[model samples]
Target: MKVLALKFENYRNLDDAIITPCDGVNVIYGDNAQGKTNLLEAFWMFCGGHSFRGSKDNELIGFGKPFAKLEVRFFGQDREQTASIKFKGNKKQVEINSVAKNSAAALIEKYCAVVFSPEHLNLIKRGPSERRKFIDSAICREKLKNAVVLSKYNRTLNQRNSLLKDIYRHPELEETLSIWDNSLLLNGAILIKQRMEYLQMLEKRAAEYHFGISGGKEQLEIRYLSTTNAEYGDSIEQIHQKLYETFEQSRADDIRNGCTTKGAHRDDAEILINGKNARLYASQGQQRSAVLSLKLAEAAVLSERMGEKPIILLDDVMSELDSKRQDFLLNKLDDCQVFITCCEQSNKEQLKHGKIFNVCNGVIS
Candidate 1:
C-alpha cells in the first residue's frame, strides 16, 4: 500500500497543506517540534483510529480551531482509494471512498501500516504491557474483528472490577459477580486464544529477523506467560475451564484487592535474548534492534496475510540506531513505501532514492 497524497486542516501544529509523496522513501526532516512527526501522524491516522502518540481526539485539533480534518488518497487493493477523518469537539467521523463509516477502525480493512517511534523501543526496555500492546495491535491489523473482541474484553474487565469494589462494600452484591465472570471468561478465553495464535507466528518471524540483525551470534525467543495459567495449544473451552476454576479460587483475593486479578489483562509475554530477559539483559542497542526486528516482522506478517506490503512509518528513530542498522532501514527496505521523520538534514544524504520535504514552524515545503 502507498499514500498518493495527504491533506491536513487544523491538525495539530500543521498549516493547511497537501503533500504528494514519492512511491519509495519519503523523508520529512526539520528541527525539533516543527511538525515532521505530525506529518507522519497524519499518514498513520489512516491506518487506525487514535494517535500513535496517544493524543486524544480533541488534542489532534489545533488550538483555537473548532475542528480538524485529515484526508488521504492511497493506492491499495488494486486501485486508488480515498479516505478522510473529521474531528469536532470530542467526536470524530470517518469516510472511505465517500461512504460513511461508523468509526475509524473501518479504515483498518482499507489501509494497513506499521509504525516505529522512539517510544516503541520500550517494547524491550519496559514491562510486559508494552509487549502485549505490540502483539494485540498486530493482531487487530490482521483481523479487524479482533479489535471488537479486545474492546469488549476491556469493557467487561472494567465492569467486573467495579463489581469487585461493590462486593467489598456491600457483601450482599457478591452474587452478581458471577454474571461478569461468565462474560469475562468467554471473552478472555477467546482473546487468549487469538493472542497465542498471533504470538506463535510473530515469535518465529521475530527470531529469524533478530538472528539476522545480531549476525547469527545471539538467539531471541518469545513465549506467552498466561495469568490464568492457560497452556499453549489449549482449546477455548479448555482455557475457559481453567480460568473459571482460577476465578473461583481467587474471588476472595480479588475482592480484597478491589480488582480483577486473574484474566487476560493480567497476562504477559516473556521476551528473551539468549535465554535471558530482554528487558533486563539487552543493551540499549540490542533493545532497539530487538524492537526493530519485531516491527519488521509485523510488516512482513501483514504482507503475507494481506498479500501486499504495508507502509512503514519511522518517527525520529534513525538517530538511535548505528550505521549498520541504518543501512538496513534506508537501503534494504526498497519494496515498501516508507515515511521517515528526522531532525537532521544530513540524514537526507543517506537515502539512495527518495523525496525530502522540509518542515519549519508547522509549514511543510
Candidate 2:
C-alpha cells in the first residue's frame, strides 16, 4: 500500500497541513518536538484508525482545540481509496470512500501499515506482554478477522475475571463461571492456534534475517509459550481440550486470586539467541538487531500474505542504530513504501534519492 496524500487538522502541533508523499522512500526530517512523529502518527491512524503511540483521541487533538481531523488518499489492492477520521473528545468516526465503518478493525482490514520505533528495540528486553502485543498486532494485520476474535476473547476474559471476583463473595456464582469458561476456551483456543502457527512462520523468516544482520554469527529462535500447554502442531480441538483442562485445574486458584489465569492472555512469545534467553542475556546491540530482524521478517510475512507490501513507518528509530544496521534496514525496505523520521540530515547523502520533507513547529515545508 502507498499513501499518496495525507491531510491533518488540529493534530498535536500540526494545526493544518497536507503532504503528498512519493511512492518510494520518504524522509521526514526536523529537530525534536517539531511534529515529525505527529505526521507519521496521522498516517498510522489513517491505516488503522488509531495511534501507535498509545495516545487517546483527546490527547491526539490540539491543545485548546475541541477536535482533530485526518484524511488520506491512498492506492492499495490495485485501486485508489480514501480514508478519513474525525476525533471529538472521547469519540471518533472513521470513513472509507465516504462510507462509515463499524469499527477500527474494519478500517484495518482494508489498509494495513507496520511501524518500527525506538521503543521496539526493547521488545527483547521487555516483559512478555510487550512481545505478545507485537505478535498479536502482526497477526491482526495479516488476518483482520483475528482482531475481532481477539476483541471477543478479551471481553470474555474480562467477564470471566469479574465473575471470578464475585465468586469470592458469593460461592453460588461459582456455577455461573462455567459459562464464561466455555466462552474463553472456545475463543482462546482459536487465538492460541493462530499465534502458534504465525510464530512458526515468523521464526524461520526472522532467523534468516538475523543470520544476515548478525553476519551469521548468531542464531535467533522464537517459540510460542502457550498457557494451554498445547504443542505447535496441535489441532484446534486438542488446544480447546487442553485449555479447558487448564481452567479446571486453576479454578480454585483463580477464584482466590480474583482473576482468570491459564489462557491466551497470559501466554508469551519466547525469544532466544543460540538457545540463551535474549531477554536476559542479549546485549543492547544484540537486542536491537533482534528487533530489527523481527520487524523485517514481519514486513516480509505481511507482503507474502497480502500479495503486496504494507507501508513501513519508521519513527526516528534509525538514530538508535549504527551505520551498518541502518544500511541493512534501508536496503530491506527498498521494495516497499517507507516513511522515515530523523532529527537532522545525518543520512541525507544516502537518502538523497527519496522525497524529503522538512518540519518545524507543526508546519511542513
Candidate 3:
C-alpha cells in the first residue's frame, strides 16, 4: 500500500497541512515537536481509525479546536481509494470512498497499516501488555474479525472484573458469577486460539529474520504462555474446557483480588534468545535487533496474507540505531512504501530516491 496524498485540519499542530509522498521511502525531517510524528499519526489514524500513540480522539484535536479531520488517498491491492476520519468531542465517524463505515473494523477491512516507533524497540523489556498489543494489532491487520474478537474478550473481561468487585462487596453475588464466567471463557478461548496460531507464524518468521540480523549467532524463539496453558493445536472445545476449569479454580483469588485472574488478558509471549529469556539476558543491541526482527516479520506476514505490502510507518526510530542497523532496515523494506520521521537532515543522503518533506512548527514545505 502507498499513500498518494494526505491532508489534515485541526489535527494537533498540523493544521491545514498537506503532503504527497513518494512510492518508495518518504523521509520527513524536522526538529522535535514539529509535527513530523503527527503527520504519521494522521496517516495511521486514517488507515486504522485509531492512534498508535494511544491518544483519544479528543486528545488528537488541536488545542482550542472543537474537532479534527484527516483525509487520505492511497493505492492498495491494485486500486486507488480514499479514507477520511472526522472527530468531534467524544464522537467520531469514518468514511471510505464517501461511504460511511459503521465501525473502525469496517475501515480497517478496507485498509491496513503497520507502524514501528521508539516504544516498539522496548518490546522485549516492556510488560506483557505491550507484547499483547503487538500480537493483537498484527492479528487484526491479518484478519479484521480478530479485532472484534479481541474487543469482545476485553469487554467480557471488564464485565467479569466488575462482577468480581461486586462479589467482594456482596458475597451472595458469587452465585451469579457463572454468567460472566461462561461469556469470558467463550471469548477468551477464541482469543487464545487465534493468538497462538498467529504467534506460531510470527515466531517462525521472526526467528528467521533475527538469525539473519544477528549473523546466525543467535536463535530467537517466541512462546505463547496462556494463563490457562492452552496449546496451539488444542481445539476450541478443549480450550474452553480448560479455561472454564481454570476460572473455577481461580474463583477464590479472583473474588479476593477483584479481578479475573485466569484468562487471555493475562497471556504473555515469552521471547528467548538461545534458550535464555531475552528480557533478562539480551543486551541493548540484542533487544533492538529482536524488535526489528519482530517488526519485519510483521510486515512480511501481512504482505503474504494480504497479497500486498502494508504501508510502513517509522516514527523517529532511525535515530536510535547505528548506521549498519539502519542500512539493514532500509534494505529489508525495499518492497514496501515507507514513511520515516527523523530530526536530522544528514539522514537525507541515505534516502537516494525518495521525497523529503521539511516540517517545522506544524508547517510542511
Candidate 4:
C-alpha cells in the first residue's frame, strides 16, 4: 500500500497544503521547528490512532482553529482509495472513500505503516512499559485480534486489581478475587501467547537485519519474559492452571499488595547484541543501528503477513545516519515509496530524484 497524496487544512503549522509523495525517497527537510516533523506526524496519525507526539486529537488542529482536516489518498490492493479523518473539540471521525467508518480499527488496517524517530530509541533504553508498548503496538498493527486480546486483558487486570484493593478493606471479598483471577489468567494468557508469537517473528526478522548492518560480526537476540517459566507458559491452558496456583500461592500477598501481580501486563521484551544488553550498553551509533535494523525487519514482517509491503515514511531519520547507512537505506528503498521532509541543501545529489516540496511558513510549494 502507498499514500498517493496527503491533503491537510488547519493541521499544526500547515494551513492548507497538499503533498504528492514520490515512489521512493520523498524527503522533507528544514530547520528545527519548521514543521518538518509535522508532515511526518501527519503520516504518523494516519497509521497510529493517536498523534506520535502524544498530543490529543484536538491538538492536531492549528492553534485558534475550530477543527483540523486531513485527507490521505492511498493506492491499496490494486485500487485507489481515500481516507479522511477530522478532529474537533472532543470529537473525531474517519471516513473511507466518503463512507463513514464504524470503528477506528476498521480504518487502521486499510493501510499499514511503521515509523522510527529519535524518541523511538527509548524503546530499547526505557523501562519495561516502553518495551511492552513496543511489542503491543507492532502486534496490534499486524493483527486487530491482538487489540481485542489486549483490551480484554487490561480490563480483567484492572478489575482484578480493584478486587484486591477491596479485599484489603474487607476480608469477605476473598472469593471474588478468585473469579477475577481466573478471568485475568484466561485473557492474560491469550495476550502472552499472542505477544510471544509476535516477538518470535520480530526477533527472527530483527536478528537477520541487525547481522547485515553489523557486517555479520554481532548477533542480535530478543527475549520475551513472562510470569512463568513453564513450557508453553504462553499457552492459555497452561497459564490458567499456573495462574490458579499462583493466586492460591499469593492469596495472602495479594491482599497485602492490593493489586494483581501476575499477567501479561508485567511482560517485557529484552534486546541483546552479542549477548550484551543493548539498551544499557549500546553506544549512540549502535542504538541507531539497532533501531534502523528493527524498522527494516518490521517492514519485512508486515510484507510477509499482508502479502504486500506497506508505505515507508523516512522523515528526517536518514540525514542523521552515516553516509554508508544512508546509502544502504536509499538502496533498499527501491520497491517502496518513501516520503521524506528535508532541506534542499542536505543533498541535492541524493534527493534529486524525489518529489521536492519546498515547505515555507506552513506552505508546501
User: In TM-score terms, which candidate is top?
Assistant: 4
Steric clash count of candidate 4? 11
Winner on lDDT (2 vs 4): 2
**TM-scores, all models, native as reference:** 0.88, 0.88, 0.86, 0.89
Tens digit of per-residue lDDT, candidate 3, span 186-260? 888888888888888888999998887776788999999988979989989999999989988998999999998
Candidate 4, residues 1-365, lDDT tens digits: the string is 88888999899898587788877777676666778778888886767457766787777889999999889998987899988888887577888888987655566767777777777888787888988888787777777687888888788888888888988889897876667776677777777777777778888888887776666677888888766553333466876677677667877876799886656777677888889999888777677778877877788788888877877666556545555556555555677877655554644346545666666677667
Better of 1 and 2 by TM-score: 1
Query: What are the candidates' C-alpha RMSDs?
Result: 2.6, 2.7, 3.0, 2.6
TM-score-wise, the better of 1 and 4 is: 4
Where model 3 places Cα greater than 4 Å from the true spot, the runs are 15-17, 58-68, 86-94, 100-105, 165-174, 215-217
lDDT by residue (tens digit), candidate 2, 48-104: 677887788899999999889998899888999998888999888889989988766
Off by over 4 Å in 4: 102-104, 230-235, 341-353
lDDT of 1 at 251: 91
lDDT of 3: 0.84
Better of 1 and 2 by lDDT: 1
Tens-digit lDDT string for candidate 1 (29-100): 899989888889999988777899988899999999999999999999999999999999889899999999
lDDT of 1 at 177: 92
Task: Give me the runs in candidate 1 sitting further than 4 Å from their true place.
Answer: 61-68, 88-93, 100-102, 169-176
